[model samples]
Target chain A: MRRLISMLCLVGVVLFGACALGKVEISGLFMKQAGYQESDIRAMTEEFLKMRPDIDVKLSFVAYEELHDKIVVAAASGAGTYDVILLDCIWPAEFAEAGWLLDVTERLSEEDRADIFPEVLSAVTYRGRLYGMPWLNDWEYFFYNKKMLEAVGAKPPTYWTEVIDIARKLKAQNIVEYPIIDAWGQGEAVVIQWLQYVYAMGGTLFDEAGNPTMNEGKPLEALEFMVQHMDEGLFNPACIESFYEEVRRVFSAGQAAFGLNWTYMYNLANDPAESQIAGDAVIAVIPGFPDGRRSATCNGGMGLSILTSSQHPDEAWDYIQYLASKEVQKKYSQNALPIWKSLYDDPELIAQQPELIKVAKEQIHYIFDRPQVPWYSQLSLILSEELQAALTKAKTPKQAMDDAVSRTKEVMERYAQ
Target chain B: MHSKVPPTPSGMYPRGGLLRRRETAFAWALILPSFVFIGVIIFYPMGLSLRLSLFQVDLTRRGAGTPFVGLANYIDILKSGYFWSSVGRTAYFTVVSIAIEMVLGLFIALLLNEKFRGRSILRSLLLLPWALPITVDAIMWKWIFNANYGAFNALLQQLGLIEKYQPWLTRPWSAMHCVIAADVWKVTPLVALLLLAGLQTIPRELYEAAEVDGAGWFRSLWKITIPLLGPTMTVVLVLRTLDAFRVFDIVYVMTQGGPANATKVISFLTYQEAFKFLHFSRGAALSYLITLIVAVLALLYTRAMKRQIEY
Candidate 1:
């Protein structure tokens, strides 16, 4: 009996030791190309450990498109595999609504709350609750080849009409093959650009009750303007199939005179090896509408959230806070735009990377988020289809908008009660 | 009464009696692990999907419970024009892609059957497309089909075939055809290899006998080659048909069923419904519907296989 007790005690001690040494797994969509290197992550992990040595952090990198799917699968199975997650801004509503994330509103201090941008905060908030911390903030900015603009005897366009006029002039000069390019593929990227144009033209997609009103005249007028640009050859018809990478390639090759893209392209465009006109490229705000209202760019960024099933919420929250801190944000700003407002004004960093600073400041006033809803992903797809149909001449602008509104209403009604 | 009077020794007992029972139990134990694996991995999820399909669950709502709503998901999916259209589109893609692949694959296999110089090298080269990953192939084709800078348009313009670039993946019919072309290019090699294996089993003596009878090449082919190749062709067709029916990766990467869902297949639609739309239950329902159709095909294939075996 004594020997048996000793054997059992030995087993218990071994199990305890195994459990004690286990690492807290935090899954995120970080890639080397996206500027999150393993060495950098390891350095960050060391810093985190110095802050709290009791916690052992294990990071799992997932591809961007696969991240949400992995989280959904893991969360639905009640698996505490992912204690921390990096989510897209639009995903928080669906994830939090699904009870997959821990509500961090009460955990955040008032000062911490004040540090985050309001637009980002609104994106991560659902039903008066915060579910995520903003990490990186992205918005579209206008990019123009300074040399090409000069060669065409034109200046950078500041308004929508000016943009069209410059394209027309460039086309007549035959200086560049494609005058302007934007991501107009049948995906979220195209929908994001379309929304910017629609809002610039003073169109609204939803009413006070959160009901879709895209069939209205204002929205139609906005879509007509977009189609007119395509029809007039200001924008390439090939844009119907072009994605972000394609746009980047065309602009980098100096075949395109002007382009509108997210802030991440700034660094790539500035690289002399990758770009033909690297030093001569300039960044500015997207051209405003004829009515003087500046176009709103769709928000594109990632947020950090803690899973509700996590056994290490406190540790995960610490990591989130660390990522959102001013120091880390400054370091992150060197590669990608950090969401914290303080980093935008950092003189040293701005002086070192003027184009990045220009993009940060110019995009601040025009940043807008997609609809905050659990079904936003689906809604975005529906919007993309309808808009593409109009752009491709498969459906008239009015008919397409009407179809989108009706379909959106149907989906909203299905989810309402 | 006689046996009770004098029970046989244990060793003297018939080996079939006790040993058979033990062997049966041992066999079951060996198979039990595999049975459990299949039940957990395949059947359990399928059963859960079946249950979810009957419920009104979004899985995207916070604290929202899956409420029982029998046949509602099915009714909704059936009622939607989008669902039926995607199904029709998927069927069209499968039939056309499989037919073209089979014909082209058979022709290539026959051509390669002839003894030639660098025959081994040619066989290795044939596998290049099949060896490449589906995503890699899709991306390569996307660039190749690019309207302006693509190799196809460049070649066409060089030959003075057309003055301008064609929007290959933008228009409705052209987009679907372009995807089919890419699909056929990537998978025809696989079908060719399978048919080549079938051709290798054909005896040379039969062709010699046909030659002695003055039967031409086409006559011998029709009389000897095809009849003997029946079982192999059936297997290849069944496998390719099923694979083509579930085609997703190529379309997803290339066009994303784009330009107004012109090339949207059933799998893509289910994926969009589940992951993209967060309508998990609805997506599960659609998946089961697809499974049912595929299962019917599998049953037919099984019957055909049984007939082949009997023959």
Candidate 2:
């Protein structure tokens, strides 16, 4: 019996030692870019471990939809299974407010803080506390076929009305099957597109009292204008039912003359192997209102947040700082547009990719964040339903907006206290 | 088979009754573990779901105290337009899909029941759709219905059916039809298998006797095969109806209740409310409404089964 007990103890020690040697797992949802892959993360980890070999890191990738669902489940369970998590820019308020993230304000240095774009930093902060470090910066951009525009005797539109006129000309000349296409599906893309018009028309979804004012005159006017454009055949009738990939397919296939898409689509549209109109695609800022005021594009990207329940908070903080460093940012920006202002101004990289650098500079000032609330996801769904109702002609714009405002108010009240 | 014995010199009389009672108790003890397992695994979660449906709880709201709201959740669900719409949609889907599946599956089962060359190969081929995962099935249908470049449109255009490709999933009725078509493809095999089992159980003597009476093939099938298959058909319809009412994965993967909420079933709505919207209380309410619907259908099925069995 004594010998058997000693043998069991010896085996337990061996198992525990093996577990202690296991690598630290860091999981994230990476945006699929030109050269971003598991090897790039492995290379970064190896370099970081050269200075501190005591900590080991492993990486996991999730698709965008899966990532959102996984994070919500993980955070709600308070399992602390993920030591480091990648969160979208708009998620910090909800995640941080739920106490799922560690407050990282004191961990970051003032110099490191200054290195990030102000808009990006502000987006991830809530109630004057930094909860995450910005990793990437994304904004919507306009993609137009230069050859198609030239054939139709139209230049790239600089204003909303000019865009409609260009679409009309393109249609008349048969330069493109669909003159314009945007992601109007019941998803985040539609919300972003709606924000563009809302901001252009100087409207807001909420007031000081936190009541949704979407039914008011200005927002209604903007929505009506959007519906009218669809009615006038300035945009594809199917745009109201399209997801990102669908719109991307149309634009890439040269069926659409103009498209509003993300910065990452620039490379995809310009790749001759993937695109028929490779050399003809031109990247420009999303068109502004006719009154010379540029409309705002929804700012989207990911941030590094340490799980509050994490046992290895210190190590996780180290990883966050490493990811936020200027050197790492520059390296990552080669494939992804890092949120650091220093990397955006890097001369050598900019010389290689002038269009990307130009886009980064142009969109920086026009970036706007979505509503930061714990129930933002629910609000987004409600808004999408209302928008779809109006687009499908099932309900008048006023009726849909009124219903949406009432539903939002009710949901807010339910979660109030 | 034995009788009680007289007492011995040591006063140890035959105590067969007590001994038999003890043996019975020992046997029950041996089977108690399995009973405990079934109770814990199956009944416990069901009981928890029932209790949760009575409370006002939001999983996303960390540290919020859940209050006992009694039947408020259920009442709210009954009163809400969204809940009724989803319920109506689920019912419509369940009735349409089950009816179509039953008729097609019965026909296919009858075909396979006949002796034919390559019958075994055809049987195996029919099972392929059911054998594939729901996600794969959804993706296959999605590609088949792709607006610009899909096999369906290609076939149609080749036959000069239309001038341009039709957006099958972009239209309301077409989207629902597409989902139903995919569902029929996936579930018909199970229905056919069930009907095949029922067909096998019919006594060959009855068919021989019917032929002796000069009953034709169609008459034998109508009078003998279907009558004897009534119990099995009831079971199949009940099972299929329950499954069809709760369909989620395929629609979720394919359209996600899109094209203006034409395909929004109760399960999908419940999932969206619970996970996507993070309104756990509302989700619980919707789930209970689905349970109520399934229970009513089951009761009706039980009554029909009882009548058939009695006949």
CA error at residue A108 for candidate 1, angstroms: 2.2
Full-model lDDT for every candidate: 0.81, 0.79
User: lDDT by residue for model 1 over A1-417, one digit each (tens)?
Assistant: 999999999999998987887755454434333334456656776787788766667777754555667787878778787887777778877887778889888888898788677877776777888888877666778888898788767877778888888888888888865688887888787788888887777677888877788888567777888788888877877788877767777888887888888765677777899887787778888887878367677777667788888887887888878867777667656556766666667797787677678756766777777887778887888988998899889999999999999989888877776
- A329-362, model 2: which lDDT tens digit per residue? 6676544677777766679668767887887688
Task: List TM-score (chain A only) for every prediction.
Answer: 0.88, 0.89
Q: Give the TM-score of candidate 2.
A: 0.90
TM-score of each: 0.91, 0.90
Retained true contacts (fraction), each candidate:
0.67, 0.25
**Native-referenced Cα lDDT, model 2:** 0.79
Deviation (Å) of A269 in candidate 2: 2.1
lDDT of 2 at A341: 73
Stretches off by above 4 angstroms in model 2 are A1-14, A20-22, A25-58, A207-210, A216-218, A231-234, B1-41, B59-64, B204-217
Docking class of 1: medium
Q: What is the TM-score of chain A in candidate 2?
A: 0.89
